[model samples]
Every structure is written in structure tokens, then in C-alpha cells.
Target: MTIRDTVIRTLAHTNWRLALPALVLTCGSLIVQAASEDPEVVVPTASPTTAAINPAGVVTPAPGTAADAASGVVKAPIAAVAPPTAPQAPAPVDEPLMKLPVNARHMLVIDDTGRVLMAKDADTVVPIASLTKLMTAMVVLDAGQDMNEEIRIEDADVDRLKHSRSRVRVGATMTREAALELALISSENRAASALARHFPGGLAAYEAAVAAKIRALGLTHTSLADPTGLSPANTSTAAEVARIAAAAARYPAIARISSDKSSAVEINGRPRELRNTNHLVGAKGWDIRLSKTGYTEEAGRCLAMRMKSGGQTITVILLDADGSAQRLRDAAAIRKSLAKIAAA
Candidate 1:
């Protein structure tokens, strides 16, 4: 069957939850095969692209978006969905997109007054990488389990889907709070996995809550398949990502943990220093309140930060930057430029 027809049949015939991996596999295989046959086609990576997956865990691309070319979902880009009008907060005073470094698929800068200083592709949906953990942390907190409760990492927490390795071992145990701290501070996939595994009913339940929270928060474009963001299906737009950064900053622990430069933690009875994934957090003259960085061959490099500069606070989001260094450079440039602008 064709990718589109297979997807249609998967939706109509089987339990969608179980069919996602198959869908991702088939679609990715087909796309790669086609790309190899066409010499002119330049696929970024031979592995199936993350955009090859979606909320349903299926490889069908949401038409017209970046993922379309990857997953073979050929169609016009979907128009922006206008949400029901509500009491409008004053829009942030608009500013122009200043000179920015390349490799950014989407970028947004929103200031304290709700002014959008600069934005590009803010509405474009894309894979968010481990930024999904911010919501995972929130959901874990919402469950109201004792942060001090003890939990152990297991084989299941290992990234079987991606086969990504982890510093936290299969049998090591720690307080739920520690796992959470590691998740936010270091973007540890195993830490995130363990946190979800320890959730009331476990990872499946945690994932369900994540989906619910996305809908509840009116994050219309965000979709999460797993807590660790190992699943390429974990996706969101730059606009929704900024909103998530704001909400995540509201949690004292999230704000504190994410902004901490580094912390010492014990895993497998050995002391290890867990450092913030976003280097801008500790860079001189930069005041980051909450930050998270994520990267995968599929999603590229991503960053979300609530930065405080002078008297103004802004959420700066960069998604799918070409490399780690480029994303940081883009952020630092933004801060310096904005600070100069505000001073003037």
C-alpha cells in the first residue's frame, strides 16, 4: 500500500496506538528508498526523519508543513487555525527580525509587555526534541506524588526506541525530585524516562496526561508521544513553545533547576556533575531564568529560554538550529542586540 493509503488504513482498521511504530517504519523506509532512487533528492539523514511521525505515532506528515517533504505527505501547507477570540492581552509591540545567524528553522522573541520583538515561522509545527520534558516535569508535579519518593531506573527506561545510552544505570535509584532535577538541568533522557515510569500508572499514563495537558493548555499544535522526547512525534510550534516556557517558569523548581549552572548528583553510587544543557544559562552577563536544550539527528538543535535582561524579560525560542554552537550564538546575539535596543 502507498504511504498515504497505509496511513488511512491504519486509522480505519487498527488500534492507532499500537500501529504508530509500524507506520513510522514503513513511511521512513519508503521515503528513503525513493530518495536513493532520485539522485537529485538530498535527504538530511538516511534515518527516517522525525517529521515522519505525529501525535498518532504515525508517519503521515501534517500537510504543507516541513514534515511533508520528509514523510511524503505532498500537499499545500495547512493554514493557521484561528482560535476563538478571547480577552486579548495587548500584543507585544512588534519589532523587526534583526540580523540573525542561520540554521534556525523557527524563532520567536516575546517581551515582558507581551510585545513580539521578532518572530519567524512561529506557527510552523516541528519536532521539539527534549523540550517535551518541561511538560513532563509539570505533569509529574501535577500528579502530586512525593518528590522525595524513591524510584529505580529500569531497562524499560533505557531508550529502546532510539537506543540512546544514559549515565543513570538500569538499577540505580534516586528520589523522584532528583530525577526531575536531572531531567530539567541536564536533559537526561533516562532521568525523564524514570520519572515517567514512576508516574502513578507508569509511562503510558504519563503520556496520556501529557496529551491531555497539551489540549488543556490550548497548545493546539503540540503533540507528545513519550515523556523523554525520544519519539519523533513530540512536536510543537515556536509560538506554543514560548507559551510552554512561560508556564514552565511558573514552577519554582523548574525555574530553579533549569537555571542552575550545575549540580552534583549520585548515580550508581558515584558522584556526577549534572550541568545545564543550555550554556547560556551560565554565560557571563546573561540572566536566564528557565532554559532547556534538545537535539537529535532528526530534530536538529532546539532551545527554549526565559531570559531576563535589564528590566525586561523575554522568551526566546530557537528550534532546529543547524548545530549546538549556532543556536547558542544566535541566542547570545539576540541578547546583546535586544539589550542595545532597549538601552536606546
Candidate 2:
């Protein structure tokens, strides 16, 4: 082996190695150029400008218009809507009747149309006591005399009970209207008897008028022996008393006068404020249109009312209750029953 032969073999090996590296560098340069020319990928330049590219590789605003300098309008993300709040539960109702400590002997409730809603011995006759004054006022109103006419209290008007309350003294003069007001509002026995005595046909015919009115109103279980219910003979049932309340409600004046809780009237030429015996008229929960309360040893405590409850009109009559508290409780019981029925 000479030196020349050794050099030629080495040079050929070196050329083979250089040819492989040159081929790899050419392929890499071509790949990079191709990627740069692709329209989908855009490289940002040094100029203070942004390009808008759609999803499909389309460029907008042609690179130099006002839109190219201004930022694109960004769509705001939608906010999630909140669900509605849950409905609240109804408030609990208190039962006033359940708090009463006494029981009543007879009770009844009727609709404004005279249809019975509830009854407990409603048809059994019981002494009506002072409830007779309701019919007495009805008789006086029917007598066709001027309400402003004056009448003098006589000895007959005074109650035999020495300590009993009275608005009129013997020989004192008061108008018919004032007397009727005192009679209905305060349950004044003297005013009632005075009105009866001054009726067109006097006391006897006045009693007849009361009976006739009871008959005309179709109150079959009612009987009247006196203008004031002081006479134990004046007796009626709860059903009949409810009918009387309905009939009285027909007369606006009677209804207005009966429901008045308090009023000022002249007695013996002085102003006397008369308070109603029926507490339901002035009670907070009652919308009383007509009302009357009665009490006697024979009748106990009695109450009748035309009232609105639970958006419906009703008549309530409580007879021979043990006390005033019991009569009020009876009324509250009927109201509670009606409310329950309405809710159902």
C-alpha cells in the first residue's frame, strides 16, 4: 500500500458522510418555508396592530382601515338566571271559642238568606228576655208616627226592680227617635215601655203589632207579651231570633241603630251617652250589621247578630248562655266553623 492509495480511500468515505448531512438540511429548510407560507397560521409582526382571523382562516379589515387599529367588539358572556323563591306557608289561625270556660244551652247560625248553617236546640222555645225590644222598635216604626214626636215617661215605664238601670225619669219628655235609640243601644226598659205606650193603638195594640210582625216574618217559635222582654212570657227560639235579625237587617235605620256600639242621646234635658249591650257590634273581628243582647234570670245571656265573616254574610243567635263570656264564645265558635268550611 502506497501513500496515494491510502489518501483516496479516506477522501471517498468523507464525501459520503457530507452528502447525508446536506440532504437532511435541505429537507428541514423546505419544511420550514412551507409552514410559513400556509394561510391558516399567521405570525404577528412588530407593528402595533391586530388581525382578525375567522375560524376558516379569512382575514378581515384588509390590514390598514380604522377597524385594524380598533379592537373587535367582544361578545359578553350570558349570566345564569336565578330560580324563583318558594311560596310561604299560610299563617295559623287562633280559635277564640276554644278559650271559653262556659257552655251555652241553645245556639244557631244562619246565612243571610235565612238558611240554617248550624243549630243546637234552635227550635226549642226559651225566655227571650230583653230581646223583645227588637220587636218593640219594629212596632213603633210601623205605627206611622213622626219619629221626632215627644213622649213623657209615665209611672208604668219604671221597672219594679228598685236598682235596675233607666234613662227616663217619671214625667221626663224625650223624642220618639231618642227613646228608640236609648232602648236599642242601652237596652233601657223605660224607653221601650214609653215607646210602647205612645204607639198609635197604645200598649195593647203595640203588643199585637209585635206579634203580627213576628208572624209576618215567619218566626213561628216567637211570642211577645210585652214591648220590653222583662216579662218572662216573652219567649222565642234561637231560630226565631235569627229570623228577627234577618228581618231587622232589612230596615237600614233599625240595622244602623242596632249595630251602634255607643251614641249620645238626651235624657232629662241632658246629654247621656248610651253604650250598646251587644259587645259584638264593637268587637274587633266582627263586621256586625245588626245586633242585640239580652239577659234575665230566666233567659240567661242571649245574643243575636247579622254579621259578615269569611267574606260571607251570616246570622248568629245564642240563647240562654251561662254568661256574657259564653255568649261571645258561642259566636266565635260559629265563626270558626264557618271559616273551616270555607277553607275546605
Candidate 3:
């Protein structure tokens, strides 16, 4: 062939090759759109046993091909192109570490050395309901009152502010020791009020002593209006309440009477059984050295405990929990979080 004829043949082949892909793509798109718009029309997909297409865009059936044997029609495989992906949201900045799973409105966990391990709103002052008995017991013990001396619960001992129910009736009489147990363990309001009334100089003197004891403990955010803790005016911060737990833990009677699971004492000439207000005191898996629980409409649920965990004495103060179960759950969550920290 002449050189011009050979060049013309090569140009025609190149143009055909370039046009073939566009023709195939257009046909495939039309087939897909047709199948979608009219479901009755079947779009044949390539089968492994069908004839294959060559670079020249012609179907060449291999030996024993089903499509070649059945008919002259053979489908070409559609090119697989992935759909464009959406831009990701910058991978979320690695997400700041999750906070502890404590739900108490005020929470504080401190080591024996008074180092705060975790806290939330610990400095906010809030009403501390029956926890006032801890201070009452402390001041009464500090005064060196005769624990065996008999004190009778009177009408004055009846809680008028909250009108809280109590098993320790107004006519009941018990030793100061029994009264202390009733106050701290059962959270008996009348028993607590009787103890304050029988103080060396009565309720006024007891209030003065509580103020002095608060100052002595170096607590900056604690105030008590009554010994029974029924008044909403009795308030303290979670941090200061932890301090109070620590101070109260120092007293052997306060620790023992408060932590005792149950105590039997003579009242109204009959033996009465009083169980602790804080159920965790003797509960399994707990090593509570001292425990106190408090509640009121204004205070919600409050808990204070000096307990041993991971071989370290910890003071856990949870204030303003919604319920008893929630307070206990918050304590358990704290323990679990502490365990994770210890392991880490």
C-alpha cells in the first residue's frame, strides 16, 4: 500500500477505538434508564457462560458458551464505577473523653488524704436533711454527756416543721446512747430532738455547740438550724459534708452507732429493733467505716459515707440525688470509675 493510504487506515482505526467506549456507555445508560422507567423491559446482565467482547468491540464466543449456543445475542459486562462519597464530618475531632457516669446533682469522692478524685458542683451549698444528726452526735459526744442517762421523747420532740413520721414515739424513753443510735441509725426525728433538748443547756446550747464544732472542723460552708435536720435551713456543701463525715468518723461511738446494721434498745418498757438508715452500712461488697443518709422535700436524697475501696478509705458525698436507689447507683458508678482509674 502507499504511505498515504496506510496513514489513512491508522487514523480511521484510532477514531473508531475512541468512539467505541462512548457508544457502549450511551447504550448501557439507555438500557438502565429504560429498565427503570418501564419495569416490564428486562435488561440482560452479563453471565460468566456468555460470549466476551474483544478490544475491537465484537463478541467472540468461546467453546461451549451458553449464549452462543442458545442465540446470537450476548451482553457485555457494565464497567463498575463507584458512586462519589459524601464528605465526612471531619472525623469528629477524636471526641473529648467521656465523663464519669455519676448522676447526683452534687458529688464528691475524696481519698483518705482528702485529695478530691472527682467532683461536680461540690462547692454548692444545699439542704442536708437528716445528716444533721452526725453533727448532733458529735457535739453531744464532745460535751461528754452521760450516754447511759435516760432521756424521754416529749411533744416538743415531735417534728412540726416537716411532720416527719418516726417509730420513736413521743412517750418513748431511752438512754442517751439508744437515742443517739435511733437518731443516726434509724434517723428518728423525735429521738434526735430529745437528745438536743436534754443537752447540758438545752436546744439553744446545742445550737451554739454545733456552730462551735463547725468552726473547729474548719468547715466554711455548713449551717444547722436544728438537731433533727428536718429544717431546710440545715445546709452544707458537698465538700464540707465530706469533711463532716471525716470528722464524725474520728469518733468511735459515732462511727459504731452510725454504721451498726441494727440496734436493739429498750423503749416504752419494751425492746425495739432499729435498723440503720444507710443500707450500705452492712451490705455485701461494702466496707463502710461510717455511713449516714438524709432526705427531705428540699434536700432530695443525701448520702455520706467513709468507706474502704481499692484498699483506700474514701469519703463519698452524694447530695440531691432523686431517690435512694439513684444515690446508691451514683455511689456504685463512682466505685466502678475509681476501679477503672486504679487499673489504668
Q: What are the lDDT figures for the candidates, one per model?
A: 0.76, 0.71, 0.76
Q: Candidate 2's error at 262, in angstroms?
A: 0.7
Which ranking of candidates, highest TM-score first? Answer: 1, 3, 2
**Which ranges in model 3 have alpha carbons more than 4 Å from their true place?**
1-98
Per-residue accuracy of model 1 over 205-238 as CA lDDT, tens digit each:
8878888877766677888888888788898887
Candidate 3 similarity to native, TM-score: 0.71
lDDT winner, 1 or 2 = 1
Best by TM-score: 1
Q: What are the root-mean-square deviations of the candidates from the true structure over C-alphas?
A: 18.7, 32.9, 24.3
Q: Clashing residue pairs in candidate 3, if any?
A: none
| Model 2 TM-score on a 0 to 1 scale | 0.68
**Higher TM-score: candidate 1 or 3?**
1
Higher-ranked by lDDT: 2 or 3 = 3
Candidate 2, lDDT over the whole model: 0.71
